[model samples]
Structures are given as structure tokens and as C-alpha cells.
Target chain A: MAGINEAKYMLGESVRMLKSGKVSNLISVIIMGFSLLVLVIYILVTLNVSIIIEKGMEEMCVYVYLEDGVNNSITEDIREKLLEIESVRRVVFVSKDKALEKFREQLGKNSDILEELGANPLPDAFRIQMKPESNASVAMEKIAQAATGWKGVDDVRYGKKWVEKGEKLVKGFYMTGLALGLIVFLSVIFVISNTVRLSILSRRESVEIMKLVGATNMYIQVPFIIEGAIQGIVSSLLAMALLWGVCSFAGRYLPGLGFFRFEGVIGFIILCAFLGSIGSFVAIRKFLKR
Target chain B: MLVYEIMPGEKRIIAGVYHLSKVLGRHFALQDINFQLANGEFVFLVGPSGAGKSTLLRMMYMDDIPDSGQVIMGAHVSTMMKRRNIPRLRRRIGIVFQDFRLIEDRNVFENVALAMKVAGIGITEIKHEMTNILTRVGLYHKRYEFPGALSGGEQQRVAIARAVANKPAVLLADEPTGNLDPMVTRGILELLFKINSGGTAVLMATHDVELVKSFGQRIIYLQDGKIVKDKEMLFRGNLRESISNSRVDHRAKKFTEHSIGEDYDGKRGR
Candidate 1:
């Protein structure tokens, strides 16, 4: 009966200390907020850059031209085969006459040259629009095989160098972003832990007095933990607000800047909140044990 | 009849520390000391500075562990006890310090209530008991006042109230009246006596030889970290002679009244 009452009283005292503003709750909140802010900015920038690379790849498609007198059935088969590959989105056929008309339109005064030629020498072509993540080199190789030994196919034209460079840039951004995020996360943890440690050091006398009064270690520790959690929550909110402001500002003015999808940005905000809380908890736990 | 009675001369051996030696880092704080305490006994421990009185008291409360020897409290041996068991032991033995280690953040009532709280007493009961104890210490009117605002004597009284709030079986006070005036000293001593008479054993360490000569029921004198004398008195006839021809000489006379200004400076320097 006595023990239970005593435990309840200790818990009440801990609550009182927390509410009285005696335990450096404000300092913790501020530290946590600042840390979350830095972390969120790092995350958002990394996310946006990755979006830009991926979107650029999707915009650039490859075009392949066929030789004169190429069999109609063979050309149709090649288009169908290109479509079978998962990377290929769709393929459209361009006839020889249509190609010649397009060339004439490109050169307004070139109609006389075309009439002088007296015959359509231009070749038909197929335009291949692939998925965003498609490997262009692999698609080209497959296309070359499909068109091999076919009569009248002149050549296959695709931007192999451009696709390779784009893919490399995307991968580089992803790796760099991942590495930067890890560094920022660790820095936040270090900062928060040290902040909590300083607070504990300043109030060691109070802790000693509590211990002498028969307060259990847990009773002594609860306020610090609460302070940490509160700091985490408040800091996370601040970080989220800052991120939202920057994103909105960019969205308004930087119209053509490819960035994180709106859905991904929202997901990142939620993730930041979770991380803030968890980081605070871990920081408090580490400091209190000491 | 008293509400609780400790049989006369029955001598309840509530706790004993045997041949305890404690080495903290490179310092030998307490060395091969032995002491025993019984229920309802009032004993004074007199020694000069650095005589290890506080260290001995800390061992009794299980705050510090002894490197060797056994500390037996009630039915349990302390050195073998787990950390979780130490609080239960502390609940039965209340300790008061000369500095009056009250939580500066809490008011007088909350300070007293903290002892009961750590012991797990219910809130309703904590309120009632803290009120009663503060009233007994004559500080009920100042219950809501913070410790920093109270005078030295009043702060010491609050410390006393906190120590006895849970009705501990034994009370250990390290110079409870060390910094108070004569009138306040007598009042604090009387409060301690009242508690002792109510069945809690009181062990107080003091440098006040005059006060000891006047009111000591039993004396345990320490010199150079050893018990030089242990005696009991049914009357003050022999005590007066013992005080007059004491072996220890005091170079400083009249026990200079260190003002509150000097008190803080002295403690801070230490």
C-alpha cells in the first residue's frame, strides 16, 4: 500500500517539474527544431535534383530510319518487335512520302530541289518513345537484332551517348543525395545529444537531491525524456514549416525547375516528423544513461 | 501510553555496520570503522572537520558502498543488496544534511512531500501528511514558499520536516543545527528529541560541545577517524566534569559566530 502511493507521488513530482519550466524543456525544443530544419532542407534538395534527372531522360526519345525499298511487312514487324520490349512505350511509322513532305516543309525554297531530284530518295523512319527508366543502349541492341537481315533497311539512328550520360547523371545524384542525407542525420543526432547532455550537466545538483530523497532512477529520468520528446516534436514542426515555405516559393517562381513530385514532398514531410521524434528519444536515452 | 512503545532497556538493534572500509579512487574516505544503532536511542557523534562523519553516515544510508565489511540494516545486509533494494532501505532511514539540501525549485510543502512521494505514498495522503509535518515544524504558514526565500533556521526546519515526514525508523542528521543561532539550535534539538521520544532512533553529528554537554543522552566521540569514547548519562553530574577536563583542546574560543555571509563563503570554499 505504501509503495504504490510513493510511486504515484514520485510520478506526480516529475510531472510538476516538467510543467514548472524548471527542466530546460525550452532549450531542448529549440535545439531539436534547428536540427530538423537542416535535415529537411538536405532531404528536399536531394529529392528535387533526382526528379530533374529522371524527367530529362523521359523527354528525350530515339529515332531510327529505314533504307529505301524496305519491305512493308518487315518494317511493320520491326515496329511490333520494338513495342514488345518493356522499355519501349510506343513506336510510330513514318512513310517515305511523308518524310519527303516533312523535309519540304523544313525548307520553304527546297521544293525546287526536291522536284529536280524527280524521285523521293528520303527513307521512312520509326520514332521510339521509351519509359523513363529504360536503358536506351539495350533497347537499341534489341532493335538492331530485330531489323537484321531485313531487305532495304538502311540504318538505325539512336542517341547512345546522350542516354548513357543522362543515366550516369541520375545515378550520381541518387548516390550523392544518399550520402549527404546520412551525414546530416548523424550531425543532427550529435547536436541534439550534446544539447541534452549540457542541460543534464547544468541540473546535476537537482538530480542528486532527487536521488537522495529515494527517487528511483526512472523518476529522475522522466522529465529529461519528456523534454527531449517535446523538443523533437516542436523542432520537427518548425522544419516541416520551413520546408513547406521553400517548396511553395520554388513552385511559384522556378516554374521549369524539375523537383520532387508533390506526393513525394508530402511523404518527406511526414518522414521528417517521425525522424525528429525518434532522434530526440535516442538523444535523451543516451544522455540519461550517463 | 505512547502511540508506539519501544521497551525500556530492551535495546532494539535495528542496524549495524561492521569493520567497514571504503576507498574512493585514490582516497581512503572511511577505514575499518564499526558502529551499531538501536531503536529509540539518541546518540551524538562529535568530531573535528575531516573526521569522516558524513562518509560514515553515507554508508549507513547505502548511498556509498564499502569496499569491505558488512552493513546490516534491520534484516538485510547492504553490501550484498541490489541497487533497487537501496531505496527501500533509505525509506526506513531518513538523512538530513547541514546544507539543507532542499530542492530549490520546489516550495516547502512540496519539498516535504517529496520524501513520501519517493516512498510511493498516495497524493491525498501526501498532502495530509506533509501539512501535518510542516505544522509540527511550525512552518505550515510558509508551506508554499520556496526554500531560497526562507532564512537559514527556517530552511533547516524544513529539512527536518522532510526527514521525519515518512516516520522513518532511524534519523541521521549531519550537524542539523550547525549554522543556526542558539535559540534556533535549542528549538531544532527539541524537535529532534520529540521525534526520538516518539520511537525513531536519532543519530546527530555536531561540533557544538556545549550543546552536547547540556543535552546529550548518550555520546559517541570520534577522534582521528576512531571512536574515542562512548558513554551514557542518566544525569549531567559526570558529563560536566568530562566536558571541563576534556583531552581535546580548543584553540579557538567562544565558537565564533560566523555570519550568514561567512557561512556561504566557507561552504563554497569547501
Candidate 2:
């Protein structure tokens, strides 16, 4: 019963302290809001950029060339086998004559070179569209195994270097983004904790007097914790509002920048709320113990 | 109602300090002290500068725990009590420092009300009790005024009011009259006397021997962290003689409005 009353009294005092219109409270709230806003923007930009990179990677296609003198049945059998692999999304079989036609279309006035060749010298090829999520190394390995030792198969061709580099770049971006996000979050906590400590120091006299009058330690600590919590929640709300405004404005004016999505916005808002409350608790707890 | 009473015997000791010693770094604040105060007794602790008078008072209030020896209050030993029990022990004893130590942010009523609030009293009861105490301290009109706005005497009265608001069984006042005028000092001491008369034990530390000589029921003298003398005067002998001889002088002294600083220095120098 005493603990409950002390909690309520501390809460009341905390609210009273905040309501006193001290300059420290104003400064703390502003700093917290700004820090959290920066964090949210960083997360949103990183998430969108990652999505764009993934979409771009999905557009890359691989072409497998078949050798001359290969039987039609053998070519059809290879095509069937390629389609059996789960990574193969779609396979387009381009005949040698059709390949020559495509080459002529690309060359435009170079049709004479194709005619002089006199027999569709270009071999038939299977244009493979693998699933976007397929493991690059695994997909390439499966393709090589399928085409190796097959009749009339000349080579399996793909930009293996580009695929490997792209995957590495994507992973690097994720790690760097995570590290940066954590740094920003910790910096926010640091700033909030200092602000809270200053506020607590200024009210040290009141705390001493309270203690002298038989107030328990919990009674003295509660109000500061409540003040910190209020700062966290208010700052987070401000940050979310700012983020929503920016996202909405960008969506309206920047037509080419179609990267921003709303599916994760709710999750981001919840994250901000959690960060705000937890930051407050950490800051107040640290200040009170000191 | 039948009131069963026991036979008269030795006075019940409310607080006892045995060979109490407190050291702060290389310096000894209090050393080799032994004392006890009985229930419902008013005593004066007199000493010169650096005599550990305030330290002794602080130990009684459990503000600074002694480095050695035992401090027993009522049925509980101070050293054996847990940190959680300190507040409960403190609630039974009220302390009024020379600095007043009033919460400046709170008004007179709120300042006095805080004692009951910390004790977990209901708000309505606190309101009634606070009003009564504030009026008794003669600051009922300034209940809404902040401590900074009050005069030194009024502030001291508010401190006293706060100390008594919880009806503490023991009151330890460390130079309660240090910052007030002699007239105000008399009034404050009179208030303390009234509190003592109502069955609350008060142990006031001051260098004002004249004040103690005038009204102190019992006097304990200290010099260099050790008790020099302990005297019990039932307002007889020289106490009575001094009162009769200084009656006119006392009236003049009460009306003269001498500075407490001068009085404190004069008394301590003697």
C-alpha cells in the first residue's frame, strides 16, 4: 500500500515538474524529437534503397548457348531439363535462324553480313529467367551441371563476377546500414540521458528535502522517470508526424521516386515509440542511480 | 475508562547512544560519547564551535550513522535497522536544522502538509491537520506564501510546524534559533516548550546558555566531543534566583530586539 501511494505521489510530482515550464524540459524534448527524427529518416531511406536494389537485381537474365549439329530432340530435352530446376522461372528457346534474325534487327543495315554467313552461323540458345530470390552461386552451379556433357552444348554463359560483386555490395550495405542505425540510436540515448541528468541535478534540493521528510528512494525517483517518459512519448509523436509529412509530400511531387512504401511505416512508428519510452526509462534510471 | 498505571520507577529511555564515534576521513567529528534521553524530557545540548553538537543531533535523527558503537532508539538498535526501516525510524523523530531546510518550491501549507504526505496520510486528514499546525505556528495567514517570502522567524516557525505536524515522539533541533532575533528566539523556544509540555521529547542544541539557563529543564554540556557536565534543574536554586533578579531585565531584553548572532557569540564566548 505504501509503495502504491509513493508511486502515485511521484507521478504527480513528475507531472508538476514538467508543467513548471522550465527551460531544461523544453530543450530536452526538442533534442529528443530531433534525434529520433534523424533515426527514422535514416531507416526509411536505407529500407527503400535496399528494395530498389533488389528489384534491379531481379531484372538481370542469363543466356545459355547451344552447339551446332545438335539434334532437335536433344535440344528439346535440355530445354525440358532446364525448366525442371526451381530457379528457372522461364526459358525461351531461340532457334539459330531466329538468332540470326535478332542479330540483323540489332545491326539494322548489317543484314548483308548475316546473308553472307549463308547458314545461320549463330547457334540456338536458351534465355533463362531465374527466380529473383534464387541463390546466385547455387543457380549458376545447377545450370552448369545441367548443360555439361550434353550433346551440342558449347558453353554456359552468365556475368558471374557482376552477380558476386552485386551480392557482396548488397550485404555490405545491410551491415553498414545496421551499424549506422545502432550508432544513431545510441547517440540519441546519450543526449537524452544527459538532458535528464541535468534536470535531476537542478532538482536535487527538492529530492533531499523529500528524503528528509521520510520519502523513500522510490518516491524521489518516480517523478524524474515519469518526466523522462513524457519527453520520450511526445518527441516520438513529433518525429512520426514529421516523417509522415515528408513521405506524403515526396509521394505527391516526386513521381520517379516510387521507392517509399507504407507497409513498414506502421512498424517504424511502433519502433519509434518503443525507442522513446525505453530511452526515457534508461535515461531516468541512470540519472537517479547517480 | 479505567486507566491502569504502573508504580513510579526509573525514567524510560527513548534514545541511548553508547560510546558513539563518527570519523570523516582523518578528522574525528564525534568520538567516545555516551548519552541517553528519556521519554517526555526536554534537554538542551550546549557547546562551543566544533564541539560536535550538530553531529550529535544528526546521529539522533539517523542522518549520519555513527562509525562505531550502538545507538538505540525505543526498542530498535540503529545499526541493526535496515535501510528500508530508516525512514520509518525518521518519521518518529523530527529534525529542525539551523538552515530551516524548508522546501522553497512549496507554500507554507504544502511545506507543512508534506510531513503527513510522506507518512502516507489521507489528503483530507492532511488538510485538517496541516491547517491546525499552521495556525498553531502563528502563520495561518501566510499559508499560501512561499518560504522565500517569509521572514526568518516565520520560516523557522514553518520548519517547526513541519517538524511537529506528524506528532513525532522526539524532536531534535540543531540551533533552531541561530538565525532569528532574540525576541523570535524566545517565541520559538516557547513554542518548543509548549510542544514538550504536550508530552513530546525535545533535544535542542545551542550555544545560548542564557536561553538554556532560562528555560532548559535539563542541560547537557559538551566540549571537544565529550560531555563536560550534565545538570538537572527543576527551576530551583540559581534558576529561581536568576529568574527573579532578571524579571525586569528579561522584559527589557524581550522588547529590545537584539541580534541572535551577537547573543550566540556572547553565550559561546562565556
Candidate 3:
């Protein structure tokens, strides 16, 4: 019963504080929301960039052109051998006629140029898609080298230089993304915690009076912590809402961009709430110790 | 209603200091101080400015621990006390300051109610009890007034109400009436006496010797971080036995002997 009464009083005190410091609280929440919005925007951009990169990686295929007049048995043997490579995900055989047909479709108005040639110039090839996990330059190079040595294989070709350059670019992007994310995360925490500290400092006199009146440290701290958690919830929701607005507005120009899933949104809100409470706890603890 | 561990053979001694000493910088703030406050006893701790009166009172409330010796307030022994238990100890012991120390933002009722709330009392109970506490302090009509809006004396009354709201076993007042006028000082002192009569021991520390001398209550005089006299012990002729320290007892006796012949009629002197 006493515990219940204490909890009631603490909650009431929290509400009273929130009401009394409405302007400051709102300002703090706004600042926090803006910071979180930056983080959300950064995260969304990274997410979309990674998705696009993955799609580009998946489109890269190694084409193994067969020697002239290769027989069906020889083509099957070459296909089986290509499938045996660890990096190879799938192998599809494309005959010369099919290749020429694709070339004509790609040419469109220029199909006459291809038709001018008496015989088909394209060769039957085994197009191998590398597994997404093994699509790095080294793995692509190894697969191409192995296929080039196979029988009935005239040439094995992939955009080896392009693959190497893309891998380096992707690696650099991820490294920069991680470093920037960490800075934004730390700065947001710093700003929020400092806001909590300032709020608590403003009420230092009240805390001292409470201590004098025999209020326990828990009694004094619970209200501030609750207020912090509330701030966190409000700011995070505001950030998410604002980010959604920005994404919607930007979607007109940049289509098919990804947003955080339901679970990620929920997880982020919970994390922010935890961060808020921990900040209050730390700030209040330092004051109380003195 | 928290259980208090009674030191063996001194059940009536609700609070006391035994050979307590505290050093501040190069000087001794308090040295080998010894005194006891019996249950419901209203004792005046009198001294001049910087005589360690506040320091002694602070030790009684466990705000500051003695560098040597011990202060025992019911179950709380300053030397053995845990940091977390300080609040629990404070709940059973009320402390008032000269500045009143009321929360300016809270009204009289809310200010007094804060004490009960900290003790985990329900809002219903606090609302029910605040009226009686305020009435006792003659401020029931000012329950809704903020501390800043009230006069110094009225603010002190509100502070007193908050201090005693928990029905503490001991109330420690440090210059509570110092900021009030003479008429207001008398009123505040009368309120304190009324509270003390309700079975709560009050140890009031003040720098004014003439002001407290007329009260006829037991008075302990501190000078230069030492007890010069203990009136009750002096009259009881057990100053030496009570303090048990020959040096402190000797000084108390010497001082008491020097002033034994002075007329101390409570009304005539004032």
C-alpha cells in the first residue's frame, strides 16, 4: 500500500514537472527530434544504397563462350563443370540463335545492321550467376580463371575491373557510413543527456528540500527518469513522423526508396526510451551523490 | 513506526553525542562534544556565531559525521550508518533551518504534505493530516499560499509544520527564528514548544544566548568547539558523571559555577 502511494506521488510529480516546464521540455524534445531525424535520414539513405548495390551485384554474370561447333554433349559437360565451381550459383545455357535474338531486340532500329551479316556472329555460352555472398572481385576472378581453363571454352569474361572498383567503393561507403552513424549516435546522446542534466539542475533546490524531508533517492529520481522516458518517446515518435513526411516528399523524385520496417521502428522507439531513462538516471545519480 | 534500536540502558535518550569530534581545515569545528536528548525533551543548544552550533545539530541529523566518536540517533549510529539508510533515519528525525527552506513553488499545504509523501503516505492521508498540522502551526488559513507570498514568520511556521509532519521522534531546529522579528520569534518558539509537548524531542540550536536564556529549559552552551556548560547536568550535580570526560566536564562545571548566582527568572530577564 505504501509502495503504491509512493508510485502515485512519483507519477504525479513527473506530470507536474512536465506541465511546469512545458516550454523547455518542448524545446528539448524538438532538438532531440531533429537530431534523431538526421540519424533516421542517414540510416534510410544507407539502407537504400546498400539495397541498390546488392541488386547491381546480383546482375553481374560471367559468360563462358563455347568453342565453334561445340556439340550438345560438350556443352552439357562444360555446364556441369561450371556448376561445380564453389562461387557459381546458377548456370544457364544460351545458344547462338537465342543470343542473336537478344542482340536484335537490344538493337531495335539497328537490327538491320545485325541482319546484314550472312551468318550469326554470336556464340553459344554458359552464363553463370555468382552467389551473392561470393560476388567479390577475388571470387569472380577465381571463377573466371577456372572456367577459362575448361575444355570447349573459348573465353571466360566478366567486368573484372568494374567488380574490383565497385567492391572498393562499397567498402568505403560502409566504413564512412559506420563512422558517421557513430558520431550522430554519440552527439544525440550527449545532447539529450545534457538537456536532462540542465533540467535536473534547475530543480536542484527541490531535490535538496526533498532529501531534507526524508525523501529517499529513489523517491526523488523516479519522477525525473519517468520524465526522461516520456521525452524520449515523444521525440522519437516526432522524428519518425517527420522522417516519414520527408521520405514521402522525396519519393516523388527518387522512387522505390526503402523505409524502416514495423519491427525496426518499434525497436528504435524502445531503444530511445531506454536511452532517455538511463540518461536521467545517470544525471540524477551524480547530483544525489553530492 | 519504524523499529529503533535502543542503546542498552539509555532507552529515554532518543539522541546523543559521545566524545564526538570534527576537524575542519586547520581548526577543530567540534571537539569531544557530549550531550543527550531524552524523549520529548526541549533543549536549547546555545552558542555564538561560528561556535559549531549548526555543526553539532548537523551531526545529530546525520548530515555530517564526527571525525572521532559517535552520534546516536535512535537506531542510527553515525559511525556505522549506511549511505542508503540516511533517508530512513531522516524520516524519523525532523530538521528545520533558519531560512525556513520551504519549496517556493509549492503552497503551504503542498509543502507540508511533501514530508508525508516522501514517507510513502497516500494523498488521502496527507490531505487529511495536513489540515491538523497547519492548524497547529496557526497557518491552516494560509494552506494555499506559496512560501514566497508569506511573511518570514509564516514561512517558518510552514517549515515547522513540514518538519513535524512525519511525527518524528526528534526535531532538530537550527536558528529557526533567527530571520523573524521578536514578536514573530516568540510565536515560532511557542509553536515549537507546542510541538515538543506533543512528545517529539526538539533540539534547537541558536546563537542568541539572551533570547534562549529566559526559556527555563535545559541549555547546553558550546564555545570554541567545546561544551562550556550543560544546565541540566549542572543542576543535577552530575556534570562530571554525565559527560564522563574529565576535561569536558571540568570546563562545564567551571562555567556553570561562574554563572550559578545570576538571576534567571524567565519573565524578569526578558
Point to the candidate with the largest DockQ. 3
Compared with the true structure, the alpha-carbon lDDT of candidate 3 equals: 0.83
Best-to-worst ranking by TM-score: 3, 1, 2
Best by TM-score: 3
What interface RMSD do all candidates show, one decimal each?
1.9, 1.5, 0.8
Is 2 or 3 the stronger prediction by TM-score? 3
lDDT string for model 1 (A163-221, tens) is 77877877787888789889998998788777767766777777777677777666666
* Prediction 1: B-chain TM-score: 0.80
> Candidate 3 lDDT, tens digit per residue, A1-290?
23888888888899888998899899989999998999899999999999999988888888899998988898999888878888888899899999999999999998999867989988998888888898568877887788788789999899988988888999999999999999988888888888888899899989999999888889899889998899989999999999999999999999997789999999989988988888999999999998
Report how far off residue A104 is in candidate 1 (Å): 11
Error of 1 at A7 (Å): 7.2
Name model 2 segments beyond 4 Å from true.
A3-8, A65-76, A86-134, A141-145, A148-155, A245-290, B1-10, B233-270
Q: Per-residue alpha-carbon lDDT of model 3 for B1-270, expressed as tens digits?
A: 233333322325567799999999999999999988776567899999999999988888787889999987765678877677677777777899999998888899999999988888878888888879988999999899999899999999999999989877789999999998999999999998878656666899998889988877789999999999998832333322233333322322222232222222211110
Q: Which residue pairs clash within candidate 2?
A: A67-A152
The CA lDDT at B54 in model 2 is 91
C-alpha RMSD over true interface residues, model 2: 1.5
User: Could you give candidate 2's per-residue lDDT for residues B124-212 as a string of tens digits?
Assistant: 88887876888888999999999999999999999999898877667889999999899989999999877765555688999888878
Instruction: Evaluate candidate 3 and give its CAPRI docking class based on DockQ.
Output: medium
